[model samples]
Target: MNDKFELPPRRRLPDEIRQRMRTRVWEGLGEPDQRPRWTVTVRGRAPIAVAAAVVVLVAGGVTLLQSVQGGGGQPTAGGQATTTRPSQQLGPLLVPGVAQSAVDKCQAVAFAQTTPGDYAEPDRWRPRFSVSLPGREVAVFDAAGPVFCELTRTTVTVSPAVAAPQVLDVSAPASAARVTSLFQTANHTLAGTVDSQVTGLELGLANADGSNGVLGRAALMDGVFVANLPLSERGAAQGGRLLLSATTPTGTLTGSGPVPDGRVWQGTTVDVWPSGDSDPTSRRNQLDRCLDRALVNGLPGTDAEGWQPGARVGSAADQEGVLVAHRDDGQLVACALADQHGAELQLATRIFAPDRTANPDVPVTAVDLSWRFLTVWGAVGPRVARVELVGENTTATGEVVDGTFAVQLAGVTDAAGWETRNVLRAFDAAGNLLYEGTPVIRR
Candidate 1:
């Protein structure tokens, strides 16, 4: 039988969809997975579930507030440009880096305007970064003139690969999350989910000392990235993807596949295979995608190349704890810290797409993994849009304990016209659902 699954048809999702989804999965779905199909006995389920719950509660509250201020309809001109009072500001979540003291040691300066008005108008020039840190910086954003940040660090005109350096004061969980969201993996040709959600974020990728030679990019909503998207000529193809490789000095990143929504950097199509082979037509070499500089709070880097791309990523968060997403193989992989104390993480979990009700049996389309968590995300088109979750434990020595489980399905809406519900799912290390709260979408 040609089995086909389908999501419940609807004309439009309500504004509160984002909020309801978050509340349902994150806030404590009340019970854990009854009989999880996957489990590593040593791994517990309590702490992980609790942590996931915390994140859901916080995100849900923010979404609700945004809905109220934004109205239950689409974003308006005012809401799009300048946020009103009691708005959801984006940044390191831990600190606001606009104080004069923050930019004390920077040699050069550049401003990336994210607001809606002209730079001359201070009101339109939203205050994203308050200072410039060592390797973190921004471009003046003059589109026509010299629109790049200044760097004090010396550049070694050697191979792009360099020893990993240190980045200052960027270790908070929020900081790490912001940085990850900023660096859009070229592998995924589509305009990143970042532009749609994050209003402004600063990334700092440089040595500890106030130096230069770091590369990074920031965004204001509906700017350059969005302007070039949903490729005009190139239709949607699931081949393009993004990969972060810390195993190398330069921390190589590879993007492959056709440009689905041709907009930004859409001319040359790129693709990378599972076996690490590339076609002659692929822009694997030309597009040396790397972080030049990043800004957060106020500290922005001027040197576009002084700091190695992965250094900040490594120092700030555990390198082995990488959240890998592969479009080629259609999977999400997370590696554990590969240190002496860290466990050997290589177990990959696979889930069905959200619309899997059509086919009760064959659900998984692709999968990949390294260590901490085995994640899988893909679409079954609108027909079979169900998502399934499965896990595995790949530990050698002692028992491995995995904690925390949370899932977010972006671009979803609710039935009533009150909120947008973005489906949220939480599972334990053993692949058990701890909480299942759905939150309403505000922005």
Candidate 2:
């Protein structure tokens, strides 16, 4: 009876079919009791239950296969297929806190790339980070342009990108008009107020043909800047313009203009000496004695008493003598004696007041002296043509050159421990006294 009730034929399932069945079972669709059942009749065998069972198993396998293949797992919030990849694999999403972390990372990277000695400070730079919505790809970028670092869920890239520094404004020497003493060589002091943002300032003097020559640097103090740029003799002879440049982290700003021949004296005269109660004649006599002593000790033709009247001196028409001295208003007055052939003896004496109160119009600005030379700078009247330095032992004279008087002391010596007093005098073309002052010298 079992042989008579046997199935017509039995065939083994293919490997692909078996795998599909296993996949469906794993997907929770092919449960034993939930599978469908069917009835099948074979042609030669009695009403066979085996055929019906095989048909039922095949129908259940087909339904389970469709469920596994057609309906796959949904994606995760990070845009990654949950079925294929775990949620943790998709890197952390960019939250506000994460953005800050990215900024810190970028800053570290930037510091590593920069030289240690660079003046730029890392804290001064402001940083910004990119953001992304949930369930989307999250990426990390550098704080600034030329992105150096990029971080993703599964990859990281490093590339150099440099951003320009922040620019700052320069407010000093607002215009070419603020430059002072642009052309005057004697008092070459350039001063102006600069913007607080400026870090460096420089003054350049170039020829009109755009050739570079002299450069002066300025220092900023309490928002004020001052530069003393004394041009060389060659530089002054060549006409040029003044350029004022300011530098910041961002860029450089320049202000330029034609050099002007500024006035010798621009402001009111300052009195450098105070009034005193000394008599003029007494002071002059003392100075005369000092000169007589120097002449007797240093000169060859003079005796202890110095040149005197009726003495067998040189045959020149002008018999020189050290005359009596006096003092007027704390100033020293000494005479240079000149006995002409026919005219009476003339004493060419000049009064020297240390203070500028002697003549406000002609103010001494600078006085430079060495062992055997003297240079005087002043705003003497325009009519003055010669400047002289009268000392105890010798007289040094100089002509106006570029608004200054430089002279070499012919008879002076650099004897150590020997202190001497000298006076500066100015004269016009007619030998008329214009200005005189006692020059302060450091032995």
Candidate 3:
């Protein structure tokens, strides 16, 4: 016998609807193999309990399935069900200059911890950029349209390199600077200011033709700099300009301008006396005689016998004044206060033997050694004040008098094994090492 239960007036559902209902039933049962067989019943044809149970199962299954699938099986008012692409974590985006391995590692870590909704548009997500900082730290950024995420790690840091700044500022002098205009003088002083950042300043004297002479350099102190320059007399005669340049960590600045016309000193003579002295007139007369002697002997045309009065005679209180005179040939005659009264007068001149001369003709020509006394005689220069005899183990000193120098040499005696090498040196009134003579052998 056929034991089947069916409701009267059975209606056939569409194939698509039947498939959807089957899918819902399987989904509700959780396991497709565990789904129970269902018997359909028409309205008002079967027992109330059976018909009610069928209605409840079919309604709940259809509602749940439609919600899960976003109403896929049925059409909305728009005529078709809307769908969207599944959200996904995209592959690593490469950044220029960054290593590929680094990008891969960063992407792997970000994707593992990220969810689909973590990004508004997961499909559009990409690596935006990265920065490396100190202490082995790296920052990685991922962006999707307007949304972005920043990931930091302590593995590596890729800091961008920057260049140092080169900035400099310089101000030119308001007027030209001038030194002595005498044909033989070349000493001059220049002063200016530079930017605080500048560390050094160089001044170059160039001829009219643009050829540069010796350059003078000076260090900046609190942004101010001063340089003592010596210009070539020939270059000055031909006309030249001064070039000032300053250096900073970032760059260099340069400026050029005309220098003042150096004019010859036209003064004749200078007189100086003690500032607070008991006898002012006598002191003045003494200084006058001393200066007159220097001009007569030092100058070429001046007659030593016939005393001629100087044109300019100015006195100073401290006896620390400079005596400058101009000759007919434009040569400078300058004398500085050497020793005050009771002391010999001194003058400033380039007449002293040049430095590093082998035979400095210091007047001590012969050394007369004796058991009673020792005498050294020669025409010592007026600038020579004292002479010293230095040996390997002994020393002797002498005083300058009447263009001659003498020393006693008391303890030193002439002996066979006592032979030693000796050197004679001369010093000016100002205690400057004026001359170093050739070696003298003493036995």
lDDT values, one for every candidate: 0.24, 0.36, 0.36
Order of quality (TM-score): 3, 2, 1
Q: Lowest-lDDT window of 10 residues in candidate 3?
A: 47-56
Clash count, one per candidate: 102, 13, 4
Write one digit per residue (lDDT tens) for candidate 2, span 18-73: 55664454345333344433322211112211101121124234431122111111
Error of 3 at 281 (Å): 14
Candidate 1 residue-pair clash tally: 102
Q: How accurate is candidate 3 locally (lDDT)?
A: 0.36
